[model samples]
Structure formats: structure tokens, C-alpha cells
Target: KRILYIMIALCLTSFVANYSMSSGAIASEKKDGEKVKKTTAKDPICGMEVQKDKSTKVEHNGKNYYFCSERCEETFKKEPSKYERKTKKGNEISDLSKE
Candidate 1:
């Protein structure tokens, strides 16, 4: 009967919609609890490694600097030139290259 066919079609459509929605919700839940590794950068003032995401960040001269602690951050803030990168010149070597 036409009514029987319509009922079957509606049931199938409802089942498919529910299946898709539940699958999408499970996918989103997995993504919500995903763990990501954080990258590390050296504290310029103390030379200690610190996680980029967890450390205090400061920007100087268009560059970002990460610090292990507020003390180191303050030290760099006071004299950033002391921790600024040095470039190697002709017949010369950069100190950073040695590390």
C-alpha cells in the first residue's frame, strides 16, 4: 500500500539521520579531549628551556621571546639588547652558532 511505503521511507530517513548525528557527536567528543604536544623555547635570559604555551611571552623588535619565569622575563625586559641575537660577520663567528 502507498501508506505502508511512506511509513517505511520515513522510518529509514529517521534512522539514517539519527545515525549520522550520533556519529558526528562521537567525532566531536574525541576531538574535544585530544592532547597536543607543546613546543619549547629557551629562556634567553636564563638559558633554561620552557614550553612555549606555558611560559610568559614578550615581544621585542618584532620578535617573540619566551621565558622560564617572570624574573627572567623582567630581566630581558630591562635589557633586551643583552639577549638580542648576534649575527656572524665575514671572517667572524656568531656566539649563538657555538651553542
Candidate 2:
């Protein structure tokens, strides 16, 4: 009877530990998914905040681009020089252009 109780206790302890580990993994995955929640940026051409996934994007040179609309993306692609010129001025242009 003592041996049976010990075996049962060990089994229960093992089950509890496994359950805790699986729960922790699920919680971690939830946190990671939260981090992936929609990332947004302003369209350089139109000055509109756009969700990176929902909006059209163009990657030129080393930068990730976001667009308010397909129209803005097309305009940006057609005349990247125009946008590149403004970007060189950094946040100064971004701040001024926003207003």
C-alpha cells in the first residue's frame, strides 16, 4: 500500500510538472504574437500612417517602405529620387512635412 501511494504521488507530480511546462510554452507564444501586432508607419509621399502589413510596401536600398495607398506606392516607385532627397534631411523633413 505504501509503494502504491508513492507511485501514485510520483505520477501526479510528473503530470503537474508537464502541465506547467506546456502552459508556460503557450503563454510565451501568446507574448510573441502580441509583439507581431500591426506595425504602422507614415507614407513618405502622402503623409499618412499605414499598417506595414495592410499597406503597400516597397523596399529600396536598405530601407523598408510603407505606403498609405497603392497610388502612393506607384508614385514612390516612379520617382524614388524625390523621396530619397527628402530622406537625406532626416527627421527635419519628416517633422516639417507632417505639418
TM-score of each: 0.51, 0.47
Q: Judging by TM-score against the true structure, name the best candidate.
A: 1
Evaluate all candidate structures by whole-model CA lDDT and list the values in order. Answer: 0.56, 0.53
Count of clashes, each model: 0, 0
Compute the lDDT for candidate 2: 0.53
All-Cα superposition RMSD per candidate: 24.9, 23.1
> How well is each residue in 8-69 modelled by candidate 2, as lDDT tens digits?
45434544544444423322243634743334555666555444445566777656677655
Q: What is the lDDT of candidate 1?
A: 0.56
Cα lDDT tens digits, model 1, 1-99, are 975455445434543544444423222233447843325566676565445555678877667787655666677899887787666554532322121
The TM-score that candidate 1 achieves is 0.51
